[model samples]
Target: MIPANFTYHKASSVQDAIALSQKLGEEAKYMSGGHSLLPMMKLRFATPEHIIDISKIDGLSYIKEEGEILRIGALTTQSEMEYNTLLRRDYPIFMDAIKLTADPSVRNAGTIGGNIAHGDAANDQPALMLAMRATIIAEGTEGQKVIPIDDFFHGFYMTALEPSDVLVEIQLPKKKKGSGGAYHKVERKVGDYATAGVAVHVVLDDSGICQEIGIGLTNVSAAPMRLDRGEAVLKGKKITDDLIAQVGTIASEDSEPTSDLRGSEAYKRSILNTITQRMIRLAIERAQH
Candidate 1:
């Protein structure tokens, strides 16, 4: 099916994009990579009157570490992240997820910002962002606002982004000593959405006590889920096999997956439980290195 008729506007800059969005109001949609918006438009699920193309906007496609933060520009593609030396050395969890996201061609054009801004739990990056405790930067006519990852997703296909706001960057704490993260998902086939996915980030002290932990679940709820209960059980304590098992159980119980083509709710819960333990163990091992 073809998308509904829409006027196209190419944004020369971020400010231009915001201005166009504000002028068009709710009738305009910003197009970055177009991977997310285009599909919806084709399905007639979204029929905006105007498309403000921001894909050509410069200065929104880099990955770098500045001071205590690792900053990724909004327009950076999944392929860019997959091959980045900085990401590979410091944040393998990204690699874990990116390699599983769609195929190489899709990854080449899919932007990280679009993935999160789409507010789809099936998309891979949101859960990774949640586990990293990342920050989202958005720019509007008023200026920029920093949004915490936990506060970003409100419900299905919804986010904290205002109609006139353009997501500009994502920020994560720089990889520190003794910190590591990993992502794992159970999918039916290559490039498929997860039946259940888990992303785990951990900071372990020299003596093996867990200093910090974050657990984020994907495709198991209306919104991406952060396992605060599971994190609480492991944080500030020496991580044990028993505690890891307990966290897994907590994840299975806390996730809210529904029955669908992916699998039954009970089946997804079981996968979540097993992967939660596996990812936590992998994160710990990496942290100990």
Candidate 2:
């Protein structure tokens, strides 16, 4: 199927993109990598009258650490993150997720911003962002605002982004000395959407007490889910076999999966529980060394 007739506009910058979107009103949509929007448009699930192409906009692709934050530009492709030395050295969780995100071709064109902005539970990045406790930077007519990851996903195919706002960057805290994270998902085949997935980030003190933790679940709910109950169970305590088991049960209980091609709800919950426990242990092992 082909996308319906639509006018195309190329944006020279973030400001230009926002201006075009505002001027074109609600029927206009901003597209960067087009991986997310194009397919929806082709399916007629999204039939915008105008597409403000922001792919050519400069200064929106890079990964760097500044002061206490690791800043990633919105347009940085998944491939960039996949091969980045810094990410490999300090953030193996990203590598785990990226390796499992579609194929090399999709990773080459898919931008991190689009992954999050699309607000699809099946996309790999959102849960990673949630576990990393990342922040989103959005630019609009009124200027930029920093949105916490927890507040960014409002519902299915929805986000905190206004129609006229362009997501500009993602910010994460610099990796601390004792911090580590890992992500894992159960899929039917290569590049398939997760039947269930888990991303875990943990900071362990020298004596092995868990200082901080974040647990995020994917494709098990209406939106990406942060396992708050599971995190609370482990944070500020010594990670133990018993506690890990408890958190696993909590994760399965808290997820809201529905029966589908992926699996039955019960099956997904079981996978979620198993991966949740596994990732927490992996994160802790990495943190210890």
Candidate 3:
């Protein structure tokens, strides 16, 4: 299927982009990497009257350190993020998720903000960002606002972004020395959506009691959900194999999955259980010296 006929507009600045969106109203769709929007457009899942291309916007495509936070511009490609020395050193979890996304060609083109802003439950970063407790920054006709990644994902193919808004940057806090995170996903094939994915961040005190546990799950529900209830049970608890296994058990109780070509509701739930425990342990191992 081909997308319906649409007009195209390119904006070279954030203000210009926002203004164009307002001019185009709800009939306009913003284009970043075009990986997400184009496929949907081809399927006619989305048909907008105007395509406002923001790729030309300057200063919206770099990874830079801002005090304790890493401010990732919305247009920074996945490949850039994957190979970034700062990201790899400070937050390898982001790098882990970046490597699992799409494939070489896709990574060369897909942008971090596009992945997060699309709010696709199957995408890597939504869940990873949730687990990292990152902050998402959005700008619009109204003003700029910072939203926690947990709240940014409203549901599948949905986000907290207002129609007039563009996600400009992601601000991730500095990782403490004893903290670490990584993502693991089960994909049926290369470039396929995840069957089940888990992102875990573990923080250990000097004495090694688990100071914090952040967990995020994908494709087991309508959204990439942070496993807050489950993580709560592990935080401050001694990291035990049994306790982590119990977490895998509790994860199943919270999910709402559907049977499809990918797998049965039962299968997704089971995989979700298996991977959550495994990734948490991996995160723990990485956190240690």
Candidate 4:
């Protein structure tokens, strides 16, 4: 299906993108990789009058450590994040999550910023970002503001970004020592969105009690869920088989999946339980050594 005709503008800077968006109002969409908007446009789900291309804007495609934070430019591609030496050395969970994000063709073109900015519940990176407690940076006419991962997501295909704002960067605290992270996903086929996915980050004390834990669920709710129920169950307690089982039960009970071609709600919930259990175990192993 052909998309509606639209004007295109290549933005040379973040301010340029924001200014163009402000001028075009709600009818203009800022495009990075175009993986999300292009598809929606083709299907006629999105009909923007103009596309302000921000991909050519330099300095928005880097991964670097600043003080205690690891900062990633929004334009950083999934492939870059997957293969980055520092990221691979410190944040293996990112690699695990992006491994199933899409095929190489898509990964090469898709931007991490687009993944979060698109606000698609099924996108794997949002769950990972939530699990990692990342922060998103947005620039607009009013200036820049930081949005916590917990507050960035609003609803299905919705985010905190305004029409005049451009997501510029994502930052997270450096990976904690003695922390373990893992991502587990169940999909119908390669490159398909997860029917059920879970990303786990665990920090254990010397006594083996969970010091901190983050459980992020994907494709099981209107928004990617940061599972407080599971965290509440595990944190400050030694993880037992029974406790893990209870967390699994919490996951199954708390998820709000709908019946779809990939799965029924019951089936997806069941998969969530299984994935949660497996990820907890793996995360514990990683945390221990």
Compute the lDDT of residue 286 as modeled in candidate 3. Answer: 86
| Count of clashes, each model | 0, 0, 0, 0
The residue-level lDDT of candidate 1 at 242 comes to 98
The TM-score of candidate 4 is 0.97
The 10 consecutive residues of candidate 4 with the worst lDDT sum are: 172-181
Model 4 Cα RMSD, 1 decimal: 1.1
Candidate 3: worst-modelled 10 consecutive residues by lDDT: 90-99
Between candidates 3 and 4, the one scoring higher on lDDT is 4
Taking the tens digit of each residue's C-alpha lDDT, what string does model 2 give over 82-144? 999999999899999999988899889989999999999989899999999999999998999
On residues 1-289, what C-alpha lDDT tens digit does candidate 1 reach at each position? 8899999999999999998998888999999888889989999999999999998999999999999999999999999999999999888999999999988999999999999998999888999999989999999888999999999999998899999999999999899989999998899999998889999999888888899898999889898889999999999999999999999999999999999998998898888999999999999988888
Q: How many backbone clashes does candidate 1 have?
A: 0
Which RMSD does model 1 reach against the true structure? 0.8
List all candidate RMSDs to the true structure: 0.8, 0.8, 1.2, 1.1
lDDT of 1: 0.93
